[model samples]
Target: MRIGLYPGTFDPITHGHIDIIRRASVMVDRLVIGVAINRDKGPLFSLDERVAMLTDECRTLSEQTGVDIVVHPFENLLIDCAQDVGAKIIVRGLRAVADFEYEFQMVGMNRALNDQIETVFLMAEARHQAIASKLVKEIARLGGDVSKFVTPPVHAALRAKFS
Candidate 1:
């Protein structure tokens, strides 16, 4: 089966993330959402919380796409995470040229680590192009409405977190 790994900190999954996940599902038989445990990011949500959020979102997506979506948590290298999940392709979401520059370097590093695994980039929808988890968090923290950037559940979580 063709499996793709989409790795992100997912401090709280945003609509932009959901967009990528939805589009990536069609390219692989199974799409593994790799929840990265990057302590350096100082995530707002714990690993379990991130995983739970992804599970809830992915369940609906899997039902809609008719593809199995698995949430896997990892603290290791992204390439290693892909290998662990038996993913031959790594899916990435691109918002702008800035995102591409960083992802280009990552693709090169990942290829150096293992040339067998390929990287695929999916452009975010125009509406979601400006929605980022960090910005969403900042907006929510400042009492601004984040309904546009996240689902109700995530918006609620942010409310609860900031409250």
Candidate 2:
């Protein structure tokens, strides 16, 4: 089976992220949403919280697309995580040229680390190209509504955090 790994800090998975997940799911037999447990990054949501939230949010999409979505929390190198999960493809989302430049460099590094793994980039839809997790958290912290930027579960989590 063509298994794909989509790894991210996923402080709070946004609509833009779900878009990429949905698109990537269609291209692979199974798409594992690997949540990066990078404590050094100090993400807003805890690793377990992020995994639970994303799992709750992705259930419907998995049903609709017939793509098995598993939210796995990981530490250590991401390539190692992918290898552990038997993923030959790494899926990434690109929001703009800036995103491309950064992802391009990382892709080469990931390739150098594991030539057996290939990275695939999915372009964000025009509507979501500007939505970013940092901005979303900033807006939420300042009492701005982010209902349109994230799934309902994520929106609720943000509200709970900021409240």
Task: Please give the CA lDDT of all the candidate structures.
Answer: 0.96, 0.92
Over the stretch 1-163, how does candidate 1's per-residue lDDT look in tens digits?
A: 9999999999889999999999999999999999999999999999999999999999999999999999999999999999999999999999999999999999999999999999999999999999889999999999999998899999999999999
Candidate topping lDDT:
1
lDDT of 2 by residue, 3-44 (tens): 999999988899899999999998899999999988888899
| Clash statistics: count for each candidate | 0, 0
**TM-score winner:** 1
Q: Write down the worst ten-residue block by lDDT for model 1.
A: 146-155
Worst 10 residues of 2 by lDDT: 39-48
Off by over 4 Å in 2: none
